[model samples]
Target: MKKLALAVVVTMASSLCAMAASDVTKSPPPAPYEQVSKLVKLPDFLPGMGALFVDPATLPAGPFLAYDHGGKLVSTIYMLPIKDLNPDKRFDNLAAPGGNVDHVDVYYNAGHPGVPEPHVHVVLWHVPAADEARVAK
Candidate 1:
């Protein structure tokens, strides 16, 4: 009958629309895995007046390095996409040779050397082995 055919057509159209809508609402693919390189030493004059340095050899899709203003080698830092990280989490505590990290700063290159491609420079500070216990606490 005509009514039966109309009902069938409506059901088919609704189903198709539902399928299309579901596709649109589907979650996007997971972000690519970021490569992390080995910890490298920083140059004396990198930035902040010998306060920061990055080891060229340990670049992980980067040009990141460790930094220490006091020249004690306290912690290390690297460049990573801001979108790929948790804002509340500390990268040093997540990954680094020295567990005690003072802080981290993310900077976009402003005519600065060795930035833009790697997109990040990680600053790490050194914690004395003897002071590890005190620092940890």
Candidate 2:
């Protein structure tokens, strides 16, 4: 059962990564941005999180895609609630949809409107450390 679940996750990640990569050059990022936003209610951009999108069906444990102002894919994020993290609860092999990750930043949030739970933002940055300045609004 565990193996089957893992396989499903891996397959979803691969599909998302391929879609994001291929559609990165599109006018408005139809795959990750337009398509995802149509499925979920997200703002155009978040100060520290960048342009964000998530599959609504995968809520709470989202492999959320973050893009820069110019519509460039920057990172993949997972909002893991503090209550959900324990020895018994393991989230392994989370995907980075933007291919190679340059760095990772994990931080705490005290609950926001979209995700109203005390959770940690597990950010997998695709751009170099310096290039992240693009999303610093």
Candidate 3:
């Protein structure tokens, strides 16, 4: 099961890396979103990462954007508490070798500025240590 989950995460990470490499014009995330972005100092671009994003209506401050190495938009990161999600069908585990034990919520198309018309939204919460270790490794 661990291996299976790891494989899934690997696949997802691969998907993230090879994502839609669009040139998202840098802009402040919409109104309410700006407050948190300011608080976190979420950069328009992170060192080693292509870009950062914040979608306006996502809960708990984001569907924060994380672009691919090529500066194309890919996954989103959300720092949400476990209590907010459904207990059943959830996957909040300790991070695997290179995977997340966190809950993941995905969205398709849905339209947001800078994102391509057919895009994806990846929500993350409570990631595990295992996953963290892989990133650092």
Candidate 2: worst 10 consecutive residues by lDDT? 25-34
Indicate which candidate wins on TM-score. Answer: 2
Which residue pairs collide, candidate 3? 53-65, 93-101, 95-128, 95-131
Q: Write the per-residue lDDT of candidate 2 for residues 6-60, one digit (tens) a residue.
A: 9999999999987766664323545434434455465578787787777666777
Error of 2 at 80 (Å): 0.5
| After superposition, candidate 2 runs with Cα above 4 Å error | 1-21, 24-42
List candidate 3 stretches off by more than 4 Å: 1-39, 47-50, 68-70, 86-137
Query: How far off is residue 95 in model 3, in Å?
Result: 22
Q: What is the C-alpha RMSD of each candidate to the true structure, in Å?
A: 17.3, 8.3, 14.5
Candidate 1 lDDT over residue span 1-137, tens digit each: 99999999999999997675333111220122121221223333444423333344443333332333333444445666544456674445345533445555456533233333434444444444443232231
Sort by lDDT, best first: what order? 2, 3, 1
Using TM-score, rank the candidates from best to worst: 2, 1, 3
Per-residue lDDT value at 106 in model 2: 94
Better of 2 and 3 by lDDT: 2
Query: What's the lDDT of the predicted structure labeled candidate 1?
Result: 0.41
Supply candidate 1's per-residue lDDT for 7: 100
